[model samples]
Target: MAAAATVVGLGGGAEKQHAECLPTSCSKHHSPKIRFPFRLRGHHPKNCGYPGFDLSCTPHSEYPVLELPFSVNVLVKNIDYTSQTIYISDPHGCFPRQLPNLNLSASPFQLLSNYDYYSDLSFINCSQTQDQIWIYRYRYQIACLSDESHQVYAIDSMSLPDISCTKMYNMSLPSEIFGYSYGPITFDHLRLNWSKPECGKCEARGKNCRFKNNNSSSTSKSQLLFNGSTECFDKPSMGAVLGPTFLLVVVIAIYHVYRSNKMKKADQVKIDKFLEDYKALKPARYSYADIKKITNQFQDKVGQGGYGIVYKGKLSNDVHVAVKILNNVKGNGDEFINEVQTMGRIHHINVVRLVGYCADGFRRALLYEFLLNNSLEKFISTDKEKNSLGWEKLHDIALGIAKGIEYLHLGCDQRILHFDIKPHNVLLDNKFTPKISDFGLAKLCSKEQSAVSMTTARGTVGYIAPEVFSRNFGNVSYKSDVYSFGMLLLDMVGGRQNTVAQNTSECYFPEWIYKRLDQGEDLGIQIEVDGDAKIIRKLTIVGLWCIQWYPVDRPSMKVVVQMLEGDGDTLTVPHSPFASTNPMPTRGTTGGRTFNSELEVISESE
Candidate 1:
């Protein structure tokens, strides 16, 4: 399995420092090599490893302590980078002492449980007379139990002595220490496995792996080095070396050229085959000439955004459509097809419908149902448009957006997380019904999984949840969309962009709204009637609830829909989201407050 490349959040200087460190290093006392996904605390910077793999080295101790998930620390005995497994030992040398409290429920590591490699030891308590009699019944001595208890304990449950004992219990442990005991206590070495940062393949390819920063960007990618040589000694016949002979060199050079061309064509063929399969699966595929005919040679431009430009077009049936011609696509038309397959499978009143797509050669475009009202951005820009919407219409739009998001999360066979959920992505139809659009950054995972691993940050800066940027806030999950939805809700209420800098003393809208709510003030905004005021209050309270600092604190979209539909007066205000006058939490630090229970404390660099 290829390990996922994690784009960690770190400063340029710190990231560069870790990148410059040796690819593989060893502890001063031990020879176990440590590399990416397992960095030594003082030797390598925190960004060198995945979250929760920080290794702390002590001057006197022979083994380094690995900080596992849930903050449990264990001594590392050896690590097999090929198998992605680690042999660990208890620091106290008595594993049974801590077995009662052993918990890896939420950690990324799992204890080895293969029955062929482990056996069970049953701990039992019995009277002196019972112990003496059982020692005779079973040829194996039961005296290898706890010395303090002086009770006969069965080493293996399958071969019990057939004698009765009180309070008998068993635990499965690694069989490596089956015959080894230290004065009636067994050894405590165990094995654990992790599937992050699959570097074994890189090593097998005769390359070194490390986290490399491109320019001075805040994100980093896992890079492999070939060193201008192919030393694949593991494979037969390929291990033979080439000597300096004119004829032999020519043959080898030709082979290398053939191999390079073969690999490049292989990659292109894979992408082509994938696109071909998608075309066969869906009827939405359109030819380039057909797109030109439908779009009338790109005549009328309707709207434009960062992803692409939208043009008004008419299909053969006389139905109007909006065609988006992608601009500056980064990779192999994956994003284009992603949008096609994602929108094609979805069917909801509040979700935009995909009519067809054009993936002919290099030209790519997506055809969607045309909406007369443009986007929610235009309606919320001025007071005239705001009055036209009224509080009732705006409330309905809010609820509609929530329902669309809920559908994306729960209604689909696979849970789709729309990373970007700003106002611009929400379009309004002729009836003012809002539908979610622009799924270029969306991710799909099994409905059973609460979180998905992301290689890079996907959403806009202002609306992105803290966890998306840093794992310290929490794991990136569906709750991230709720945070963006919260920001959009606040933007709708204030009739201005939440990220914009204000000229007045107030820096952000959330802080100002929180202050008003805290003081039991009437919001002091212009309102036509008591009904409008009540609706505004409900939206504000729900917005605050959605923007809670921690993902766990934010309500899910399902709950958000319920809150918007429920009575305003009965709703309870959430805890202070903008707790301090500062509108946002400090980016680089943990804020000096203990949220250990709320989030996993992986590393200080996050």
Candidate 2:
């Protein structure tokens, strides 16, 4: 007994860990963490912590912070050392930012709320059984509870919601529970409903039985027997067969779990290969049937447009996705590519993420995270509009749009020119956060040059700057986008579309804005005396500066961001925008690179 005890102790004995982590910064300000006095030889080596990880501290906040660069923030509110989860204040402003990016590659997160996990459903015609199912599944989705790890529930001190983005009184989660396991649930909890039972194929000699028929009054003695096997159906005693049937059910459930895991592994492998090759774009590819299942046969149309109708759908148990199937009449091939290429590489908080795409033969589609609120155009340009957004929201929208465009211009290796920048293209999120989308007319410029090759003029008539339509103005540069952005800004300030044209040859409203600025007058757009007038005036001035016919007169997106952010006192009144009629000087070349310009004419993007 003593020898056995010694062996067990040795088997489970604690082994020393081989890491020594350091603090982010030294307490003394001028003195670095490892300076002249600190030893680098005796106890100091660079590789002290985990491999592929580094420590850094920033002076931006009040106290020094120790952080892992690519890993999740370790400033946990409460931690479960055993489960390795920390209840943190809403870090991502959604839910707890899972550490090591969560390897629930194994056990799926369980819900406590009823069926309401994602976009709430009105359930115009839902099944009666669903009412109680959700109650067992999820706890109430507290609005914006970012620290919702199982560990957080273990502790009760999750921080309350932050209402700075949009005021909300209570908790509200954004997805729904689409299905359930009537029997046993799997580990990952994602079993595609792809299996079927073959009761019709049951053989009589193999002891098969039908769902007890209640129609016929006359029954065979062998069929109705309390215990028998030899009969017309070779049916065994009902009691004896039930145990086998229950066992079969369990076996079937196990088989389904295996099949589901196999399918998931296959799908994940494809996604991994896709990420490896097409690292920038993450487009969801749903089978046609999956799309149909998601949208419930296109029964619920959220928004209709010239190109297509947007149907809201949930892809997974918790993933809310928007499926945009190209309308039969409006688009076809390259137009789909236009959006995919333009949105693929771009990722920003202010921009809508293109999750995935699909282009099976005869089908063209694009998938994106569903933005709760629609376009900014709808709110501002509605009949009897309220204009309750006030000035702050408008200012925020302008800044967000500018930042998005700036990302397209400078964040990517190749410069992206949003040829169509307007109120209609700016969408609002759940919190009225702005996202830029719709890139059918977008163009790409080489990293080194300001000019992009174009054979034919593109973009909406009103939003297109003068230089893009005319060559004499100057080399069409990144400033063209600046011009378009400025026009959008002016529209936001105008709070209406610049729809009126004196003739086919003129852009009436921006010209009107410039004239008013020249005479030191405010834009005549019907805006009430709200506090946002200051931001409106700034946008108007900046927009006017942006639409200057010569590219040189337009401000870069960087400066545009600064002007939007800075106080009104720092602003300079804009000069009159170059009119289409203005005689422009000769323009420069495209720096010698030549490529034929093409327009993406189809709307199918996935």
Candidate 3:
């Protein structure tokens, strides 16, 4: 910008300050780390504190208290300067009144859908029905864009009119709530400063004073240009001939850029040396040209998913592959590094292998040894024409997927729970061998730990068990993945997308399966006796046992494998499974209507 300035708004009105909000060396407890909107009280009579920030030390409490302008009574606890969030205990069970009342219309901070930064806090009203509602205030996380250095600032969520509080408050805290005030807000523009020799006549003189240039001038850094003219009466074109001088400046600027880039590359080389541990995965560095070549110049589009385009490609020597180049703005973390760090160490015959990856200055890519088949869902759902997967193939696919998930839970040194475990993530190799892919959303836990705390739920809807969705059942553990696997089995048996009928319609899958088994409806699913269909049916039953709503009821994959490979003749029917809030009708005495059309289709297609 040609000209910029900082405007400070006081509670009464606006004012200006040259120096930033840094504290001066006026006191022993003075903090220089404070910036903007935060001012040293009593340091300057001009009300130095920045707007929207109210900092105070009261004689009533042992520590200093910081208050938001809107929540006069609410005291902020534990400010993580790095993470840019503040923790505050809730004053009540429910807040009819919003502190800052986060106006989506106002702040730089925005609420995310299916996600939130300020999770509610719950204080039980045990006396009356034990009505437990989440308390209104908790820690508000500020997610700043690091590349642009986004930071969580207090004012980012506060409203301008709502930012009015008493400047002082008495803290009967951890007890009585108190009121506080917000200072003024003045930091809207950039302030430019230059030294002017005071007694500053030198600046006032037309011969030297550069305050000489008006603010309307296009450029601020004006200078005097000496002309070769012998007469002062000549047109004032002396400044225009400074072209050669400016040419010299341009040459110097180019030389500086070249040197700086060279130094940056050298620094990057040292950084690469420090990252040697990542070398074993042998992540490939692909040029944009290589990316084009591998994907046949992206001639064939694999499919479009949440992350980005999935393209089928090959390495230099014709090694077929699938490449998922993350979108420039993909929210999922770097898939290349995420996959490499998670799946790199573990090698299972049933799990997909990582061929290589690419991470350069501008371009980030991952290269995987491609699979022959797209995914199990494609063959299963494309239509009767593509229903080539019979009971045997489906059974084999189910068992293979189970083993892969089982390996993730038990085979590796760390027990990993593949959060997103559905047919979409399961790929088949050339010989119909199922290889589990996409460990990017996987979570790691230990043997002793039965559950890991998850702040937010991850994984696709419907496939996730009720226990995993809400903690009413219990904590999250590897069993969460087991629950998801159970849903997959139900889908395999039904031969249609599981989520659609369950979530949007009256069809509850597990309950439907449980009802048929109870009445002994031949499992209604036709797998041959002592053959692939029988094996798959047994696996389906075992899957029902695994996703029994309660974590304890679900069997581990180790037991599941045994059940799948177990003899079909002696297999016993498991009890009825748990039903969701909107329970589905049981099919104990008769067949389910939803499965009627799909069942005949699966049988005929097979």
Candidate 4:
């Protein structure tokens, strides 16, 4: 009986240890589960995980962080025991900055071999004067590393280019690093795998890998037992010991499943209720089968955005259309409801026409008339494309866009605020007429409402209004749309997005344009004719007027349309939009001639 008691005590102690080493996570949702060969350092016993696989929770964020050799720390995104792979990323959001000192040789993890090929890359920092020369020779310029006095570039060739540049560092990186020609180079996550203590087979069989005899010294030997001096054992089981506890878990699981089904049904009912009221709008509704037939199994993808992918399709009447298949998992049907409610009531020449919709089951899609020309983004991206559409045509396109925005604010029964207004959202027809599309982030309010409430900042970064990001700037209203349109016009004039400049010195393009105009200098852009120069000046001055820092100082779409329609002679450059001084009056004057003196003061409303 004494011997039996000793055995029972040992079993109880083992179970307690097992409970302590069970799977843990830094966050309930964001962080991955830490288990087996990979264990949380401070949360679990050192013996629970394999050597060189220890991770810890971040001090503030509580995110799982993996510390590699040389004190290089990366965020732990995921761990797959079955595949023996771990995904890690730079905690500071710049992997290239860490690559120079990243010494994976001292660590057990290695880059994924079968997935990607790697090459040695040398980072070179050169003087700013050599930028034009280097940019002409090498295409891979590292924007993050480049600064005011110097520029950084990555070269994959054997010898560095014959330029006056210093080699910053050399490291072996994936081949994809060389593929990016523009924008910042980034990796979503770096995949690594370990082969020291192979526990994949044990995991496949639903068993746990542990040191044989619970002795850490035996883990070094490869020929000791079932798995390289380690042993596979059944996971600790409480089902046999605690029947009532198991029953309670089962009941809780069933209740959770019931609750999930009830939630899904509730969502479905809400959608049905909206659709029943929306039927009166006269927009045709199609089933999922009809959607598939129209899209021909989504074969020809025309475009894709944050909301969904667009495919070219044909209706029963043989009319060509662009079908946007929205992401089903996006935002509990708010975007779909917004589009249906707003676009269904809207009818304007500048706005894209909504032909039909599909809300069959979980799948949702919106149909619109197919425009042969893609988006305004493609046209304004390069100077060659901008030249193809002469200054006069570009001016007309800007006017059309402003008119469209004006109609949305005044023409519709309820004011529609297009939160996202960038070149990508503006589609062009065969005649090159600009029509605003993508109402996914749109909001509707009464025409009398001057401002709107926003839980989060919406719209593309470069074109987003300052007020939309923070209320301290000003209240968000139709003026926010004016801000975006102003940025768009500036893009048309500059032949590129204003946010993306060649160097750090030229980072704020608007401020640069403002300074040049203030100094009585001609905008240093290619000018073919006097008419072209006048149009450029007009667009620039109007864009500056629209992008004032405060919403109260910005002109309404009504006033903006007037500015775009007027010839370039009378318009005067507005004050510096980025001025640190007190807010300037909504109306300004040059030579006692008021600039946009007709500007209306819109009261704050939500």
Candidate 5:
């Protein structure tokens, strides 16, 4: 009985440690407990806190100071976790001196002004005279004995005079603490409020929360999850003790059988549920026999990719359609359903329409309108085809893609973020009009939501936004697609053959393009003629604007469309889309290094 009790106790202790192991900063005196979204810099890893929430613990002091934007450091007095507010005070007890020309432009926090009163300070440089009678009405004067000519006074007011003060700045404070001042009230605290962390939602559901690193995966962003249990352990069963050797043998046998059966059942259930949900959607469903009849037994193979094979087909009414048969299904058919769910809800001229689907047992396929021009990939990847399509046609295709993406973002009932936006995904009809096709890696969310939590990285590597791979760049949002679109435009300018362009020894292709454009060099168009230079320049500039490192710096799809459609002469060159460490070479030499691959593009099955 003692041994059994000991075993259960150890198990419970392990569970407790797992749940409570989140990095924390505690205080011996007054500071509040700091954990997620507020981690001590050296004491915790960055994932344990929000991006800008870097708290520094002074060597021997119990208080932790938070550094806000513009390097303003404030000693944290108290933190209200539920309210997502923090009370801070000047570390040296000199509020006026510490907060001169204060600016919170770049920080995540906002100053909370709950009071009605405001104090305006006027700095004067004049001899003390009876004309300063109004200065007596205000609070104590701040002046140096050596500088008798200058006088400064601060007072609360609804309105102030247009006096000829040398300098002036205003400070707003809560009315409760705005007592009649004889001296500067330096001990008053400032309240700051931040939107509650996204992880808070996981905790609200009664589950333990932890940030998961997702660099190894290609589908989701690193975010919080409700996977771990909040409680230490489940209660052990109460029963008579059996012989140790006999119990151990029984447990081993049962575990092996249970694990095998659990694996089988889980996989089966996942596939069944996926298909059930796919059927519930409004799109038409076709049987395998019907798919074979439609495609004429896969006779005409138009394209083949890693995930599936595409064949040209025609319906009974002689309406031409393309059938994509998914051949290498990795797991439970989530990718197929993701495409179905995403493409079904969308309806736009620039967005490819999903006519129907085929999910007969293990055999699955998608039916789309047959496009004669194939993909933009063929046109951009080869020089002969690119010139044949001409720069004018390419510009229109880029505009079409932008319009499609804009409609996906704002025109829909819910915002659809296309994680993967590339040239191959853009298909052209017989008339050369482009439509966006693939949606296996799409995410949908409300229009009001600023950012979406992803479990792993999505989109191709060269095109992936910095924030999508690492949160240090910024939050992943609709702008992530903008970054990919920027890469797409750059690819268009480079004729798609020079994407990532390692042959030139350049770290990034956009840097190379920027140097050419800034120097007024021809973009090396194979067939440069009248008005061709302006169109190429417009695409390059718009692409650079879209690929800014920070999501905030990138323009929206609507603005991108306007830039593309408007006069190219009015457009300005954007900041070079290259990191400072890899500065552009003034000599313009490749240094003989070649070969570049950004996680290898996952080619769409036509």
Candidate 6:
């Protein structure tokens, strides 16, 4: 744990500051020392510790607590300043419970490298009866997280065991933990190491580390010192001894600064050029002031994503809109250009309307017509929500989304492929009409082109087609979107993420659904009426058809729309799509068919 470094002299003032920052602990005997680069919150001044290294004491237990990014607080067991390592344990005593949301990228510390000291561990939760039968076969069972009804265990294998167990999650842990032969896994503590502040060498040399510049104010000095501006010294006279070396360091620093500024200017020029070229699209451009007014200073936050935040706002005519403010745009502004240029030329009932855009300086935003209902994700995320929409409504939503994808693929003058199409991206209007949004990952190509060349895979993990990741599956094409829509339809029917392992040992849920349908078994869903059962079966069959292993084996969006709108009795179970074993027919057929025979002309490149 390294706190922000502070600039101080080796004289009287320096000695006073050091005395104030003297190592202290939550308890007199057991607690670890907290000093430079690590400070107790509310007890030490801001300059005493480095940024992101602040710790607090538990009110009742007196145990030191370290809160990581994303508000995860872990109890600090020990701090080895000499080794630059901090040992922590979950405050709730179950580290596995927090593994899903544990993020270390934003924090100063990092887990030990996976190649050397760490190994991957998969957690599986199973019923008590199954646990008893298989518990002796596995290495460790997390007793604290287990109960009478179910038991949780960790295994070294990446794939789930061939049994009725639900895969909870996966994480990397110390390699030594899996080697233990005797007892249950305690997960007693985790070791995290930090590289910043570089105080280990100073500690090894038995010398104190302090910021080199003593003339600046404490706040500014902390900022600079955190950027590796500190020096190792024993006394005030050491400064005079190191003056020449310091001067050389200053020269190198200046050169690096000049290069950084030059690069910034070049990036700015590229952004300006992009904005200028995009002006021809004739999208309504609003100033930053207008954005603030329209959003009421960003008061109503509607949603958030990796690229930006969406806020609910109103136009001058009182029409509601969703304003997405983009953040951390790259030097090329490729996403902004793709979204505006692609959405600007599109107008369809099932596609969200881009009302306007803002390119004020470095800040950019996209305005869209606000939908009353949030997204399709909210309605089909849980059992209750899924039932609230009923089987018929869910069928309609599936049909609407298919039509939207059909419009993007065939109706547009140029074909538009939505690389990312999941439940979250489909917004719902007041009438619950689905509108496909988020065109940042969309690609446009000539109508005659069948496949699009992709340098990298772009889409949500579970929803992405197999071809997008590798060429062995097939060339990337509009059929890729059909694969995603199929996954979405499965989620709507299953009322959960389709990628999750079902009751069976199979890793893929679609395979399980296919097996059930092949055996003519009920989908184990709560079907309110006979019609509901047919809708569920129909959605499942169509979804399985769309997610075929190869792009050629999957049906076109046009056929998908027809399947969803047509009677459920006419649909047929598709070939097993788990592996690239069975290739479906290329022409018109019940399972799947290509919409354009000319588009089937295969090539290495689009």
Best by lDDT: 6
Task: Give lDDT tens digits, candidate 1, residues 1-606.
Answer: 001011222121222233333333333335466666577654455455665466654433456666442224567888876777888876666555555434453345777744547676676666665646445433223443445545645446776676667645566666655444422434455788876556667566755444433232544432222111111112212223222222333554476467556767676565444322322112256677878888899899998888799999877443578999987765787766766776776767898878778887688889888888989989887767887889889999999999999998788656788889988899988899999988877777676644567778989877999889887777887888999999888877877644434454545668778767878887655697569988889899888878887777777788789889988766666657754643444221112322223422121110
Candidate 4 TM-score versus the reference: 0.50
**Which residue pairs in candidate 5 collide?**
220-455, 220-456, 220-457, 221-454, 221-455, 221-456, 504-590
Which stretches of candidate 1 lie above 4 Å from their native place?
Answer: 1-283, 316-318, 330-339, 497-504, 579-606
**Candidate 6, which ten residues in sequence have the lowest lDDT sum?**
1-10
Cα lDDT of model 6 by residue, 173-207, tens digit: 77765554834776666788999888889878876
- At residue 406, give the lDDT of candidate 4: 96
Query: What Cα-based lDDT does every candidate model obtain?
Result: 0.65, 0.50, 0.49, 0.72, 0.64, 0.73
lDDT value for model 2: 0.50
The number of clashing residue pairs in each candidate reads: 1, 36, 15, 1, 7, 6
lDDT of 4 at 508: 72
For every model shown, what is its TM-score relative to the native structure? 0.49, 0.52, 0.47, 0.50, 0.48, 0.51
* Candidate 4 deviant stretches above 4 angstroms: 1-281, 316-318, 329-338, 497-504, 580-606
Q: Which ten-residue region of model 5 has the weakest summed lDDT?
A: 1-10
List candidate 2 stretches off by more than 4 Å.
1-95, 98-281, 304-307, 316-319, 327-342, 382-386, 497-507, 522-531, 580-606
Estimate, for each residue in 1-606, the C-alpha lDDT of model 4 and write its tens digit. Answer: 000000011111134435444566776566777776776754566666765677665434445767664446788788887788888787777677777546665467887745468867788888877737545455466777778998777776575667778888776776664554544466555788888688888889987776666544545332332233566778655554344334433564576567556767676565444433322223456678878888899889988877789999887343678999988455666656556756776767898988778876578989888998989989988989998888889999999999999999887656778888889989999899999998877777766545687889999888999888888787788888999999999999986645545455555778778777889997888887669989998999999988888877777788788878877787888888885533544555433544443223333222
TM-score of 2: 0.52
What value does the lDDT take at residue 238 in candidate 6?
52
Of 2 and 5, the candidate ranking higher by lDDT: 5
lDDT of 4 at 457: 92
Clashing residue pairs, backbone N/CA/C < 3 A, model 6? 3-37, 3-49, 3-50, 4-49, 4-50, 4-51
Displacement of the residue 425 alpha carbon in candidate 5, Å = 1.2
In terms of lDDT, the poorest run of 10 residues in model 1 is 1-10
